[model samples]
Target: MFRFALSLTLALLATQATAAEAEPRWMVTTTGGAFARDNDQAHSFGSLAVTRKIGRGYVSASVTRFGSAVRQVDVTLPSTYTIGFLSAGAVHGAWFYDGYVSLGRQHYKSVVTDLGERDVAGFSHSPVYGAGGDLGAVRWIGRSWSVTPSASLQWIKSRALRGQIGPRGGSEFETRETGVTLGAGLRVDKFFGASHGDSVSLRLTRFQTTNASAALSSGMRGAFNPSAQSGRTSDAWAEVGASATWRVDHRLYLDVGAVRTLGALGGDMTTGSAGARLLF
Candidate 1:
């Protein structure tokens, strides 16, 4: 009867396209690390990320690099380069929401030591931007375990610390900050293969700030304002990690990790990483 109802509607549309290709819309990650900060003295960074999924919502993009320290007392006087942009979607099924914006640029060259005579310093630049938003929720608690919680808000524009030390000596300064962050994490996957995967995580993060202050003068109204400069100098940091992924076949993949930065921002910082991931 009419070819058996057109072969049962083409076998139910090929079983809904094989259940949407078995889920997992997209994912890509790459990381590299080595960092230590406590008045400056360690460097190494690399990052690449991409995530995509639409219909339940998801989107992401990232790129990062930070490495420059050959000597000069481990450099940190003014070394920089950071860039990020992200967007997210998901209003159900584990809940999700995201937003991100970042930009940073700073170069170095500074030496101001009088009495013994040593000069020739000129290199200072600043370009900062910020925007942030996050609200995430995930729960699985079984078969591999999973739990995630997140909250964030950020607004910063602290860029103005130029340099020059001789031939007229130059300088510049400015600061404006607003931050709030809260995070929670737990992800354990042990090990799984067919494509390879391993995971371990423990995280805790906290940050608070408001209004900030810092100003110097020569061009922007001879600035210099510092009246008690808010509160809570620094206190809150924790990150534990373990990650591994290997799928060197389908579209390439490899990731390794290590992280440490427990308590304090003016001292104590550690990180280690390895990476290679490509998917399309």
Candidate 2:
């Protein structure tokens, strides 16, 4: 997937270079990073995006691959996701509006653990799909600052899964799980440099969960259901971050940032990332 996106982006870059004598109309960005969790567990992610000017705004597409960790009482399930997105944005004076929709595939690993006198079990491989979208707006403050507020929604569904729990080989059960997340955030930015293109920003976001449920059947009933067995159903959490951007030239820019997720399941997570963008 990364190869395909990179190839397409390169092709577009070459095709658009002819028009670079005028104001550039296309942008390409690539970012990659890792985040840390409990027990020294580290997960990695990478993404590529291409954007083109359209009328008074812009249209974009992106591909991403990332790893996420889910904690059960005694075990951690590591999952990987591959996602693609289509996005669009429009500017009206000092106000800009944007939205994006995404589709993704997810894979989870089966795990098993021993807890003193008992054992917690594992889940069978099952088909999983996730879909989501976001709506956001930015309000420019004078020539050197801006404020952005946004809302997002996501849904994840899993096919019937066979699971096991208990001692020895454990009891077997079947279940299906679905979850939803709703989030809102605000960001403030301070731009500098002669071109006002370089900037530093601070952001705060909160997420709430709903209908994160599971249907369990067969042996041991709820013993192995992912959503049903979780410690919280309607939990909420917040994240805070700061970042900086450097305008390297008329056609290139670089970024570095860090964010921390607080009150998340399992424990807090800290992420560090760096990336570059090219305009042509």
**lDDT of every predicted structure (CA atoms):** 0.43, 0.56
- Candidate 2 lDDT over 28-109, as tens digits, reads 8888777775465677778788888765667888877776545455555555666677776665543445555656655555
Could you estimate the TM-score for every candidate? 0.28, 0.72
lDDT (10s digit) by residue, model 1, range 194-260: 4223334444444343432221100011111111133323234454555555556544556565555
What's each prediction's clash count? 1, 0
Collision pairs in model 1: 57-89
Q: After superposition, how far is residue 48 of candidate 2 from its true place, in Å?
A: 1.4
Stretches of candidate 1 exceeding 4 Å from the true structure: 1-23, 26-28, 33-43, 48-50, 55-58, 61-65, 68-77, 87-125, 129-162, 165-252, 255-280
- Candidate 2: stretches off by over 4 Å: 1-21, 38-40, 110-128, 158-163, 166-175, 211-232
> Mind sharing the TM-score for model 2?
0.72
C-alpha lDDT of candidate 2 relative to the true structure: 0.56
